[model samples]
Target: MSAPESAPPTRPPAPELRGAPSPRLHNEDLAPRRDAAPWRTWDLFCWWMSAWHSLGSYTFAIGLLVLGLTGWQVVVALVLGIAVLLWGCNLTGVAGQRAGVPFPVFARLSFGVFGANVPALLRAVVGVAWYGIQTYLASLAVMTMTLKVWPASQSLTAPQFLGMSALGWICFLVLWTLQLAVLHRGMEAVRKLSDVAGPVLWIAIAALAVWVLARAGWSVDWNYREGPALDTAGTVSAIVSGAFLTVAFLAGPMLNFADFSRNSPDARSIRRGNGLGLLVNGTAFVLVSVVIALASAEVHGQAVTDPVELVQDIDSVTLLLLATVSIAGSAVGINIILNFVSPAYDFANVAPSRISFRTGGVITAVVALVVMPWRLYSSPVMVNYFIGGVGALIGPVFGIVVADYYLLRRGRIDVDDLYSDSPTGRYWYRRGTNPNAIAALLVAGTITLLVAFLPALSALAAYSWLVGTVIGGGAYLLAERVHPSGSLLPEPAAVPAQLPTQR
Candidate 1:
C-alpha cells in the first residue's frame, strides 16, 4: 500500500524485426499473495469436475452414445481422448507455474508483447458469449422449478423481445446478476464454490445414474449400431471427430491455465493436478454419463441429453433429489469456472493496472445480457463453427509458448522484461512485436481454417487441433532456426509487478 519501489534504468532499444512496432518500456507491477500458490490434490481433481459436469457435457456424452458405437467403443474414445487432454493440461500447468501469469501474458512471446492481444481478445469474447448462455440456462432451471411449484405463475408468460418469454427474461436477468456477484468476489470465492459444486454435482449424477438403472432393470444390451459406421468406413472418422470436439471444449481452460498454475508450488503439483483432474476425474464422469444415457433409452424409448429431464421421468422422490442436485451444482460450478473465470482473467491480462479481478468480471456479466447468449448456444452449427475457429488458434499459441520457453528461451524468462518497452528488454522484439510468431500463427491458422470450412476434407475436420499444432509448432521452430535470436535474454534484478511471491 506504500509508494511502490522504482525500477532501474532502461536498457538500449533492440533492433526491430521486419514490420514490428516500437514497444513502450516499463516494469510490470502485478503481484499475488505467495501463500495462495499451494492447492491440495483434491482441489485439482475438482477442477476437471467443474469443467466436465455441465449441460454441454451431458449433451456431448449423449451424442457419443447415439453415434452408434458400442459401450466399450465409447469408453475407449473417452479414455484415449481424456488421456491426451491430461498430457496437454500438464504442460500448460508447468508453463503457468513458471510464469506466474495468465495465458494472455505468456502469449506475449508468441504474439508480440502487444500482438498477444489478438488471441487474448478472441478467447475473452468467447468467454463472454458463454457467460450469457450459461446464465440463461441456469435461469431456465430456476424458472422450471418455480412454475412446477407454483402453477399460478404460468399465467405470467407473455410476448417479449428476442423470442424470450417475460418469465424467461426475469430468470435470465436474475441468474445474470447472481453470476456477476459471485465472479466479482474474485478467484478465492470461485475456487471455493467450484470445490463444493464439483463434488456435489458428481454425487448427484452418480445417484441419478443408479436410480435410472434400477428403474430400467439395469439392462446391459447397449443396442449399439452395427452398420458400416460402426464396423469400418465411418469408425475412424467418428473417433477422430469426438477427440477433436473434446480438444475444442478444453481449449478455453488450457489458454487460461496459467492463471491457476501460478498458484502452484512446483511443476509436480501441476502434473499431479492435471493427472487427477483430466484423466482420472474425467474418466469417472464419462462412465456415469454413459450409464445414465444407456438406462434412459429403456425408460424413455430414446436417448436423453438433459439429466434434469431424465430425472423428471422417474416418479421416485430419491430420483428427483439426485437430479436436482446434479444439474444445479454442475451449472453453478461450470458458470463460475469456465464462463466467469476465463473472461475475468483475460480482462486483467489486457489491463492489469486498470482492471482488478472484480471489475473484469462485471464487464463479462453486462456483455452476457447484451448478446442474448441462449440463441447462440442453441444453434449446433454455430457452436461447432465458433469452437473450431477459435480452437484452431489455441494449438498454435500453445506451441509458440512452449517453443519460447523450453527451446528458444531455455526455460528462463526475465519476468520484468515481459512488461518492459525497452528494446534491450528480453521480450521486446522490434516495436514490441515478435514477427516470426505472428507469421507462423497466420500460416497455421490458415490450415485450421481450411479444415473447418472445406467440404472435400470432411474426414480431416476432427483433426483441426493436430493440424494447427504441428504446423504452427513446426513453423515457429523453423522460423527460429532460419532466424536465430541467440539464447534467451538475461533475467532482470528487479522483480516484475505480477511476479508471484511464492516462487
Candidate 2:
C-alpha cells in the first residue's frame, strides 16, 4: 500500500522492507518471531483446553451439579456459560489479529504512546493474584498424592504455618519452581507444552469419569437432578444470566488474549483455534465434569469439585495415578501460559530496557512466594471475590478495544508509529493520554465492579462483563462523537520493499 499524503515526512533512506525478520519474541516482553502462528481455529481450541482442564476449572464446571438444579438445568447453565465465553474470546482475538501486537503493546493505542503503562501495571498485578491462586491449586493436587503415600502425615498434631501443612509448602515450592523453569524458556516452550498438556489432561479426565461411572454402576444423565433442585425456574431470566456468567468469569484473561494472538501469523488461525478450543472443547470438558461430579455424588453423597478429591474417593489406585499426572501437568501448563507469560510482558512494558524477561519472571516468582496462595483457595467465597474484583476490569477494556478497532481505526494500523515518539505520531493523543478512551475505561470499569461486588447488585454478578462491555463501548462512541481524534497518523514514508504485507 502506498503511503498517504498526510503520512509523516519520509525519513532519509525511507522505511524499506528489511531483509531479515525480527528475532524470536524470547526477550520475554513480546511475541517470539521464531515460531509461526498456529491455525486461528486451533488457537481457540487450545485456550478452551487450557481454561477448563485444570483443578480450579473443574471446581467451577461441577458447581452446577450441586446447585440443586435438575440435570437438564445443569446442562442449561453450563452451555450458556460456555457460549458467553466464546463470544468474548472472539472479540479479544480480533484486536490481536489486527495489531500484530501483544496486550501491553496494544494498550499503547488506547492508553496513548506513553500512557499505556497504567493498564499494563494493572494487568500485571492481577496476574500476580492468579499466579498465587493457580500455584496453590497445583500444590493441592500434589498434597493429595502425598497424603495417600504416607497416611500417618494426615494426623500431625503440630500447628502448621500459613494454614498449610509442611508437606503443602514443599509441594507448592516444587510446583512453583517447575513453572519458573518452563516460563523462563519463553513462549515457544510454553506453546508446545500446552499443546501436549491440554490433550493429556482431557484424556485422563475422560478415563477417570468412565471408570467412576462404571464402578458405581450408574449411567451418565443430563436429567439426573433430584426434586426441588429444579424449582428455581424462570427460564427467560435464567438462561440469559447463565450465559452471562460464563463470559464474566473468563473476562480477565480474555481482555488481553492478544498476548497470545499477537504471535499468530494471521487472524484465521486465531479464530479457528479459539472456536474449536473455547466453544466446542470447553463445552465437552464441562459435560465430562458434570458427569463425574454427579457420579461421585451418587457414590459419596456429595458432589466433587476437586478432581484429585474425586479420584481419592474412588479408591482405585490406577485411576488415581492417571488423574494425578494429567491434572498436575495440565496445571503446570496453564500456570506457564496465563500467569507466567503475562507478567513477563507486563513488567517489560513497564520498564522495557531495565527488566529482561528472566528478571521480570523472578520478580513475579518472589511475589507469588510471599502471597502464599494456599490460604486464598481455602474458601469458595474467597475465590469468587478474587475473581470478581479482577474480572470487573475485563469488560471495560474489551469494550474500549473493540470500539476503537472497528469504529475508529477500521482495522488499519501503522506498524512503525507504534514505536515512534514524535508529537506528530498518530497515537499521541492529548499529551500521550487519550482522555476519551481513558474516561470510557474508568466509567465502564466502575460500573461493572459495582455490579460484581456490591451486595445489592449480587444478582447481576453473572452479567458484570456484559454491563462493562456495553458501558465502555457506549462511552467511547459518545466520546468519539463529542471529542474525536483527527485521522490515525498515516504510515511512515520511506517504505522498505521487503516489509511483510500483514504486519
Candidate 3:
C-alpha cells in the first residue's frame, strides 16, 4: 500500500539555484515556518476553552439532555464524543506541526498542487456558514441586553427585513464589525483575546451554576421524561446518535485543525493542549450545561436551551448583562479561531499571487453576509440540513487526507512540490490534479449526500459522517491500487536543498 516511483523526463533548476523569485506557489503568508511557533500547551488548552464556551456548544449539550437519556448516560456520550474529537485533532495536528503549513497547503500533498482547491474551497464555504450563524447568535445576545436595559428600544423592532427585525440588523452589523477588527490585527490579537475570554467564560458559567443551585436546590431531576420513555434498545440508540451529533457539531474544526496546530511549538504541545482542551475542558463544559438545563427546568418551569434566552430569564440586570457579555465574547473567540482563520488561509490558497491573507478574509466575511445565515438559524430543519450536511461532506475529505498521509505516503511530503505547478513535480499529476483522489472524494461524498438528503435513508442519516469516512478511505486505497501513482517516498538527493527550516 505504498506510492509508486517513476523518473520524469527532466528536473527543473531549483528555484534557489536559479536566483528566480520564489514561485507563485510559495507566498510568505502560506510558506512553511522559518521562526519558532509561539503557541504552547496552555495556549492550545485555551483555544478549545474559547471554542467550546460558545452558544452553539450550549445548544448541543442541551440537545443531548432532551434525548430521554439520564444525566449519567448523557455524560458517557459526551466523554466518548470528545474522545473521538481529541483523537482526530491529534492525528491531523501532527502533520501541520511537522510541515509548519496551514491545512490547505498541507492538503496539496494528497489532492495535487492545484486540485487541493476542492477540499479547501469546501472548507471555506463551511466556515462562511458558521461565521454567519455565530455572528447572528452573538447579535441576539446584544439585542437581548439592549432591550433589557432600555425597554423603550423594543418598539424599534418594527419594519422587519429579511426575517430579522431592524434592531437585529444593527446588532449583527456591530458584532460583525468587531470581529473584522480583531481579524485585521492578525493572529496575535486573536490569541490574546482568547486567553482573556476563556477564563472569563469559565467564571461566568461557574457563577451561573451557583445561582441555579441556590434557586433550584440539589434535588433537581436528571431524567428527562417529557414524553413516552424509551425501551433499552431505544435508549442505546439515542446514546449512540447523541455521540454522533456531538462529532457532527465539531466536524468543521476537527477537519481544519491543522490551521491552528501549525502554530504549535511542537507535537508534544499539540497533544497536551488538545487533551486538556478537548477532553477535560469539553467534558466539564457539557456537565455544567446539563446541570444548568436541569436547574432551569425546575426554577423556570421549562428547559431553556439557548443561553441568551436563559440569561434573559435572570432577575438581576447585572448578572444578565454579565452573562450576555460572556456569551458574546465566547462566540467572537470561536468565530475567529474556527470560522475566520481557516477560510482566510483557504481562500488565499486559491489564488496566492493575487489574494493576500487579508483579502481572503474579506472575501469570507462578504460571503458570510450573502448567505443570510439568520434564516437558516431561525429554522430547526435548516440547522440540521446546513450543519449536518456540511459536516457529512467534511468526513470524506478527512478520510482521504488521513489515509494518504498516514498509509500511502507514510507521512513524507515534498514541501517544494506542494507549491509547484511544473508537470515534472511530484504533486503535479495530470495537469495538476489527481484523478484518483477526486474520484474517491466524489464517490464517498455522493453516498453521504444521498443518506443526508434522501427520506428513505432518514434512519441512517445520523451516522452519515462515520459512514462517509470509512467508505472514502477504503475507496481511495482501492483506487490507488488500481491506478498506482509515483512514490511519495522522498529521495534525499531529489529533495529541495533550500526547503524552509522547521522550528
Candidate 4:
C-alpha cells in the first residue's frame, strides 16, 4: 500500500454483459463489478494495507515526529488523520457497495456521462505525474541497493541520459515493466498481490523497528524532539497540521474509493475492512515508523526517515534485501493502483470503443515519460503548486458526487439509464453534460486554489479540502434547485425499481 487506489484493468475486455452502457460507451473494464462473487472483508482490508503502508508513509510518520510534538501528540495527530481516512473510505465505499460501479461511472451521476470523462482525465493526469515521480524515486532506492550488493555496478551510474544515470534508467524501466505485468492481469490479480503484500509489509515495518530498538541500547525515547519544545498553542497547531496533511494525502484515493469497493459484497464489510486496515493497521504502522525512525537516529547519529537509507546503514545483506525490496514493492504497488489503474479506466472512458484498458494504461506510462517526472519531483515547489492545484478539483468532485447521490437523488439510482444515452435517459443531461456540476466545480475549485496558493490564506491551507467539500456540495445543491439536473427522474424512489424505460 502506498498512497492511493483504483479499479483493475489493462487486459483485454471480457464478453459484453447482459446490462451494459451503450456500445460506444461500453467496455468490459468499465462494466459494473461482476456478480460472480464479492470480495471478502480480508481482501478489502489487505488493499488498504497494501495501498497505504509503504516507505513513503514510513517517512511521513517520521516527519510528524520531527514536528516537535511529544509522542502522545504525534499519536493523537496520526490517529485523527487515520480516522478521517477511515470515515471517508467507508462513506464513498457505500456508493460502490450499493451501485457496483467505478469512480468514472459513479461520477456520471453528477457530472453527466460525457462531462465525467474530463474529471476522470484530470485525475488520470495527476495520477500519471505522481506515478512517474514515484517510480523514479523508487528506482533510486533499487539502484542504491543494487550497487551495495555488487560494487562493480557503480560504473553504471557514471553515464547519464535525460538527467538520469544508465543504471537509474534500467531500474526505472524494470519497475515500470513489472507494474504493467501485474496490472494487465486486472483488479482481481491486484487483490491477490495485496493479500500477500499487506501482511509482509507489516512484518517488515515491525522488524525494522525492533532491529533499530535493539541497536539503540534497548532504550526508547518518549519525546524525540527535533527542535525547541513548543507551547500548547504551537503543539496544537503542529498536531492539526500533521493530521491535515495525512488526510489530504489520500484525497486522491478517497475520492475514487468505490473503484476498490465496487468489488466488495456488503457495506458491513466496507466498514469492517476500513476499521481494521485504516484505523488499526494504519495506527500500528505510524507507531512502528516512529519507533524505527527515532531509534535509528540514536543508532546512526542522525535521524533517518527513508527506510531504504536506514536499512543500508545497518550493514546487513539480509536486512538490506528484505527492507529495500519491500520498500520498492510498496512504491510499485502505489504506482499501479493509484497511478496506473486510475488513468487506465479514465483514458479508456474517453473513447471506450477505441481504447482498451491496456492502451489507456500505456498512454499514462508514455505521458509520464514525456513529463520526465524527475524534473517534476526535483522541485518541491512546482510539485506542490501543480499537483496540489490539479488535486483541488478532487474534493469538489467528491462534494458533488455525495450531494447528488445522497442528497438530491436520495439514494435512488436508475442503473439502466446510467448506461443509456437516449434522449429520455435519466442521466442524459444537456449534451450529456451537467452544467451544475461544472459550475459547482469552478466555484469550489477556485476557493481551494486560493487557499492553497495565496500567502494571505496560507493558514487556511490545511483545511482547504474540507472547505472545498462544503462549498462545492453547497453550491451544487443551490445550482440544482435553480436549474435542476436532467439526471433526476420525474418519479424516483429511495431504491429505484428496475423497470423497463421508454428508450
Model 4 per-residue lDDT tens digits across residues 425-493: 667788888899999999999998898889999888877888888899999999999998756655432
Q: Worst lDDT window (10 residues) for model 3?
A: 1-10
Choose 3 or 4, whichever is better by lDDT.
Answer: 3
Cα-based lDDT for every prediction = 0.68, 0.68, 0.79, 0.78
Indicate the residue-level lDDT of 334 in model 4.
Answer: 71
Q: Write down the TM-score of every candidate.
A: 0.87, 0.86, 0.91, 0.92
Top candidate on TM-score is 4
lDDT tens string, model 1, 125-194? 8788777777777667667665665668787676667978878888777767767777777676777777
Where does model 1 exceed 4 Å of error? 1-34, 226-229, 232-237, 314-322, 485-487, 490-503
Model 2 TM-score relative to the real fold = 0.86
Segments of candidate 4 deviating more than 4 angstroms: 1-20, 490-503
Worst 10 residues of 4 by lDDT: 494-503
Q: Can you write out model 2's per-residue Cα lDDT over 1-503, one digit (the tens) per residue?
A: 12212322221221222233223111335532223434234444665587678776777666644445655566677787776666666666656655556777677766776677667766777777788888888777777876776777676424488787677777888998988888777666677677667777777878888877885687655666544443345544555666676666566678778877766655555666676776678778777878887787677766666777666764765556567767788787777777777777777766665777677788888887887666666667766676447657777877887777766666666544555556776667877668888889888888888888899998887688888889999998898889786635455432122112211
Q: For model 3, how does the per-residue alpha-carbon lDDT over 1-503 read when each residue is reduced to its tens digit?
A: 11211321122222232222235666666776534335667777888899999888888777776677876678778888898888788878877777677899888877888889899989888898889999998998999999998898888788698888989999999989899888877777777787778778899988888887678876567775445678999889888888887887788789888877777666777787888888889999988988888888888776678877777878788878888888888899899989998899899898888887778888888889987989877788876776656667898998998888877876776666776777887888877788888999999999998987899998888788887888888898889889976745564523321211212
Best by lDDT: 3
Q: Candidate 3, after superposition: displacement of residue 421 in Å? A: 1.0
Residue 147 error for model 4, in Å?
0.6
Q: List the residue pairs that clash in candidate 3.
A: 4-486, 4-487
* lDDT for residue 122 in candidate 4, whole number 0-100: 74
